[model samples]
Target: MSGQNAKPEATPGVRQFTVAPDDDGIRLDRWFKRHLPQVGFGMVSRWARTGQVRVDGKRVKPEDRLAAGQVLRVPPGGESDRPKPQRRQLSQDEIDRAEAMLIARTDAALVLNKPPGLSTQGGTKTTQHVDGLLDAYAGDDEPRPRLVHRLDKDTSGVLLVARTPGSAAFFSKRFSGRSAKKIYWALVVGVPDLAEGEIDAPLAKQPGTGGEKMHVDEENGQPARTLYRVLDRAGNRAAWVELQPMTGRTHQLRVHLAAIGHPIVGDGKYGGQDAFLTGTISRKMHLHARRLIIDAPKDSRGGGGKLDVTAELPDHFAASLEQLGFDAGMSDARPVAEPPRERTPQEKKQAARQHARQYRKARRGERRTRGAPKPDKPGKR
Candidate 1:
């Protein structure tokens, strides 16, 4: 909301940001990952060693905690010069194709109906991607629109792009804080036994799978959750389900659905060939990002309640819906007025005790570290 979208001046040789409220207790190293991810951990350590990275003009260790509203100074060059694959130029055809996908545009954001086959961002062996063509949607004075979130290459629906650096920061905070609401529609092979439920499972990457696949690993996985409601059913064969991932993880929706014995239609990777049907249904993935709602930046338009946007289903998804007798125009079943349950007195007392313990522990650790001797280089020591 600061409207400080202009590029940092060269004279200062640094860029700075005020820590957001949600980041108050996060470590300095994690803060860099949140805001300036391009600056690698190694570079941050080097900067801290050289006294280039500072919080409120005071030198701090990488593990130091950050307070909300404190100013953080970062040297400019690492952000632009960090090692990354050179972005390939987009051909005129690619640019045209990208512009053609634009469904809505605003001063702060752009929404695109991403096609099923297009990758969101480029990578090795990926010559054509949405990131490469974003320039086509930018005006002469606009900064290159930044991808606020990503969808799987085969998943099609509304994709949001931030038009300015301030907007980018604002949306990023919303996402990390779990304040953004995202709805996804998918055709699953079978119906869930219950009308609606939440799946709370932990997920981890499969070893030796090149980090492309995820599996449920209760022992070591990170917590992931999804809320599902069956919207329409076609006998025992297939069902259209609405999924809201409470925690974002790689392939969470796909993995959770499969774990429940109803893998998403055509998600062969997770559900195997059983995920497919013999009829006229397309082999393409049946998942679509249906709707997204988030708070607009405070500095914009009186800081209105929230911005709601819905995306039309892709051609394959729409056709499949029609074939399944599902009404695409149906209203949302989730209630907006669902109030939070009141906590019991015992629960509140336990929560207060837990908070006090953590605060005391963190303070003790900080005191020890503040007076601890700095480690010397291996040879020098």
Candidate 2:
């Protein structure tokens, strides 16, 4: 609840905070999370991680103990508020209820069935985020494991976390290298023509100030690849689809689907009129980060070798299956289609021009047949 009601706005953009008498020696991130839960520790950590969170105008680690009169400045960290684990506003009972769903954990990571509306992390002035309750999630570790990747703040399902920097670094590298394959379950606004296929389009950040707003440049953006197969189509209105993001980009799957005009439900930002959050749809933003498979980096501790971990779909995601018409309990979410080689700009242009020429020929033939009599009028003489 990023202090939803707090008027003590964090310095807009990037503001610096000075350690005060009441805040001495506390971990910088903890202190800030106490004051700014909405801004999230991901922001805090990225700054601190990169020596951007400065103390006395000097960068310090988020774990560094803060002394009184210390000044900390948060550098600009792009637009997507880096995530952190934040404490939720759930009560003791609510917390207890939410516990049965801890789906997976390992020495290197933990995954949770993040419920819709629960944020992954909190910020200074934010009261509760996944990080706010270190005692609960971090366990015996002095500092809790940080998030390696994030589900959208409102999305629910297998959200992964890294227990230590060694693991975080391992997975982070793997994520950057595209070694992790992600599969998602989503109910989209309408049925697609091809039952199973690929959406090869360039996705560029929407050129304005908003988180997660991206566009299908199909032309100028970075190459983003997504492969989706229609699992079930409930008439002309909706389809249950499984998506594999062959390339990792922010909202790649969402953008790809929407570019084809079948936006996912509940994706308020990019799903356009089909966003379930908006009036055009009624289903829960039918999207889930249903599965994650990582070819775990070779164990650095035990002579580099490969390790792989896989997460099955959570219940809600599976339940989404029954609604959308799949064998609700099957564990496999992999797409059946092979990805096509992406056409380069020149090739795509050539194809388009070719299509246009064909279209013009067709139109010309139609005009010659349909409009010829009106034009000649037999010379009307």
Candidate 3:
């Protein structure tokens, strides 16, 4: 609250505030709004222009990002005792449905096993979405939970929600920094040629798909990479695959798989008629957000606050796995452990020299034993 212009007269003077870890990589204006909720955007803009607000003794714009440990100079007295908007009332049915989806909850986070049909955020025609249902998780005076990431509609699995704005900022930074790990399980129409590999294709939105479809556009596309491993196979007809997308692009996994000729089952948008399999297999999308691993809030218990959460397979996806004779729990879809780092040239040379010296020492010891300690020709000694 030090940087906040709350009650400028309460403490009339310039104040220096150190940015907290939660505020790393946040915009200057947002930092003021969070810590100094009373500070208006107009005031922040004026201060930035006149050099009243500075970050680390340097004048910064309202859009400048702030890093942890940076000192923020605050000029007080723009505090506005603005009341928050009234909490939106949610229907009992909506509340019940959302509560039933709760998989895990903590002081700073909420992990939900979002159902396949539920949209993460609302859209033009989307009357009901997870964003509208988040009010169900709010406490009496707590701020509404904020979504940290998005899962595609029909992609069932673990969706993270931040309990407060501070935690939201922290989790957002982790995601943008690529420190968070996400693993998705999907059933594809056919097995890939390789058991495991990386897809480093770039993707761009298609010309006209309502911004819902993507295509691999080598000429002009954003860089996207996905690491995939075939977990199990039902002959060459279908395969269970684990996907880890390094970059968060719209429909990256689906587009990449389709581009590789192994489009995900039930993904007709990209795969066409070949996406679905006839018979007992359902025609629903088989992709499910299976697991997420990221750092927990600093206050969490156990092992420096590591947060690892996994979502169970959705009903249709689970049934597909069973139908294909694949064990739902057999593959955890964890990434392969990184190999040991290669030694530098200098270090390699030093090791070789050390080995050679050890070998020479062993040979000398053997020679000494043969020359001097022959036990005096057995009985002659």
Candidate 4:
């Protein structure tokens, strides 16, 4: 139990630079967006929101005007704000197989399933991520594609990527207007009293730490809405739930679930419990991206119904459900590689404690011997 809350040291990085001219007094976020053309504006907004992108060793607001020569530290592990040389790695055969999941493809867009634990893009100093293998996924397409939205590092589900700049603009507009429906499945700590209800808690970035959490901010927060329903009850301690996010704020579902007193188990950051370490079911939040419904661009030649894409539970989630009584080989969207499971020494210690408790109970039962001695004593008396 000791030191369970300790966070490791920050990832190491060195200073990098892109100078802002005197005339570039534009919003700090906007300025970064322009100067760092490769990085997404939202990534910059996130850094500003979280205080990672600071000015003069202090945090700067998104719209804060920039003064020339203010020192900035670009942290390690950003997918968007990093630069690297181009190279080819995967063979042609590998590229074909990975692209087989394409539900819809055009010169401008291609919607695909993004497996859990795959970062949307590569980092400044990263070894492997979803974006790291773009050569295999994107095939021979020049200039490649870009991710429009990101699932959490451990969330397995549908991800939308735009193949062209024009398509990227189209998809971005749809997302901004909330025209897309994002549905998810999460196994939570306990069942809610209501079968179906909406949680309309405003969420603000968790205080004290930057970008680490989202808390229920009654005041000084942005509007966020999440619609949820109990899918099925799991014994007494947990329940399977469905989530429909009305707003796409970071950690919105995780925060809303926590605010209502039912944090997603194994979600140590927001769910904040280390209980899942005991069973083979490590990382038990059980949240799956499940499905996404978005309005595909009306064809340049004509038009039709909205585009739908679904990514099934990766192997780990599937295995967990089977262990918990979900039917084996049940219907799912897609099959993905599972996260590697490891048994930590701490988990072994917890298991040992359980065995000791069972041993003591057995010893007590042996001593009682039901009515064996009691009857003889009564007769003697």
Candidate 5:
């Protein structure tokens, strides 16, 4: 009932606010959490149920997605009695640390090279994490950056952060749809028998581990796939490999490599004691998310091009590569267009037969060529 660009207007104890572009595509309840933090979800639902909340003059549910330029009508009086959370004040050192991890930044995204040993998000006993440091990147008026994906605490690599709620939804869709490509570099204890192959395994959480650990479960598990290529090998002791996960699963790469008898170096949780090397190699995990390529929000630029970024290896990973006589530059860490599909048994047999037929045909042609008298060299007879 009012201009879309105008600020929240209040009249007769009722308030109307137009959704900002940064809040686009999020649930109505999430919108409250971001802009109206004092309002609890239960209150929002109750208001929605009683037709007190309206969008563009129609009743809307709490889970309904909001679009930019939509006007929201509110009946007010939903502030919770509990004390609101106080935003943590970041120290100068924390600000510096967060800035140091930043590798690339755009209007819609922040690409960070998170180091090993730092958690992506805080946990019960975790006080410091990448999520806590995001406050340093935003100003009072800017939307807080949100994580679209996560990396293990010990696996260092390129981590993507969305600059706004709209971008977060966009990036999350790309990741969930498997359109975003992530390439990782790892050092394993033993070389794989095949130079390149795919691991198709189903994974589920181990029951006794309180959902903290994952294991391969053929009968009841989510499908997981990984494509790996051995770049270089130091005899049978170690090998540097490139890993691309076709499906994002918890510890997929680590568990798959271990299942094939070539456990990733320093991944003791999955590989046990065999994960360590005896020599000068660092004990820290050697897995690094080398590169990420994903579609960017069309509104950020001119509706084309993608965000392609690479992260430098951590100090320990680099040192271990040198100690193992492996060259990090050998592989360019390119993203594959699509995951290779496994061939059926019949298809494999058909391919083998075709190959043998072609070989025999070539041999027969060679024999005929040799048996036939060579053409008399240029009228020699």
Candidate 6:
């Protein structure tokens, strides 16, 4: 019962506690789980329903977010009878593997250079993943690091993890707000016609793929955009490119590139047989997250400055780059200042009106020049 988990002594039957800074922005049920581990979620829900739980004298729901310094009131007697769940212990090898991925560490965050083929979260058949490995980063008294964002299983690169609940909320906001910037390096099947351009296609999950595959669907889709710059081309076979996703759509980069007729090398899910490259190129996906730049939490010991980091390319990708005669150093992997925001209908209409006005003024000037009295024949007059 150290840190913010320690509750103040209270009178009989009822207990009162103040929301702590660490628990701020977390749900009420999460607060109970963190501080009063004996109280189950069902009990918390019942308490809220029966008006036994109150925050600042108002009945609060289990999903209500807690703010720092708020006073909480609770009725007693909701300890669970069942044994508490035990966390799985990691072996030495697992700990080593988790530590190996660490590229940058701070009081608020840990940045890992995730290797390919490792899933960010566990799925139905996925027992081992980056989430499960996070226990290795925490000590017995430390809060477990939580993932703020995700990368595809085959897409290797920098992944951010928040070390505390407050930091988790902080980082999540930056990501959702589009304030964080990420740059990716990829090898595509063919060079694009335009060396540098933006892909403004909308994306939707393909109907038959059970939401696992995405495709361009202008009629019914979410707006998705990606900025791509070709670094170098190895004849017509392959090209090295830098990619910056303007939107966080699932499989956005893969789908957009594939839709434009150039799929990343070895992205069989989107490109099928055409995704593969011949001669010494590994069949693993060639996309890798290269750099991430984001603001640190306010309470971070590192003066709350930006956390900028770059991950080295994975072995297969590096080997492929060398084999293709493409220089990885040719391009600096800097993210664009901002993603291009889509203009509203009113703004578009205004722009069109202004263009029409300019066109009409030019036309009137041309008519006046043609009608002028021919300048009286100059010297002859």
Q: Report every candidate's CA lDDT.
A: 0.77, 0.63, 0.81, 0.62, 0.84, 0.83
The C-alpha RMSD in Å for every predicted model, in order, reads 17.8, 13.8, 19.1, 17.5, 13.5, 13.3
For model 5, state the Cα shift of residue 91 in Å. Answer: 1.7
**Model 4 lDDT tens row, 266-363:** 78776555225346765745677777777775443345257776776767777766666655233333332122243365653454344334434544
| Candidate 5 lDDT, 89-157, residue by residue in tens | 999999999999999988788999999999999999999899999988877766778999999999999
TM-score (C-alpha, index-matched) for candidate 2: 0.59
Residue range 262-336, candidate 1, lDDT tens digits: 889989998777689778998899999888888865433334357778888889988998988889887465543
Q: TM-score of every model?
A: 0.67, 0.59, 0.73, 0.59, 0.76, 0.76
lDDT by residue for model 3 (155-225), tens:
99999999878788778989998788888999998888889866766678888886778876655778677
User: Residue 330, candidate 5: how far off, in angstroms?
Assistant: 2.7
* Per-residue lDDT of candidate 6, residues 228-278 (tens digit): 888889888888988988789999999878777788999999887879988
The Cα error of candidate 2 at residue 165, in Å, is: 1.4
Candidate 4, residue 72: Cα displacement in angstroms equals 43
State residue 297's C-alpha deviation in candidate 1, in Å: 1.0
Model 3: which residue pairs collide? 4-36, 8-77
Query: Which parts of model 4 are misplaced by more than 4 Å?
Result: 1-108, 139-143, 274-278, 300-304, 327-381
Clashing residue pairs, backbone N/CA/C < 3 A, model 4: 312-334
Name the runs in model 1 displaced over 4 angstroms: 1-90, 299-305, 332-381
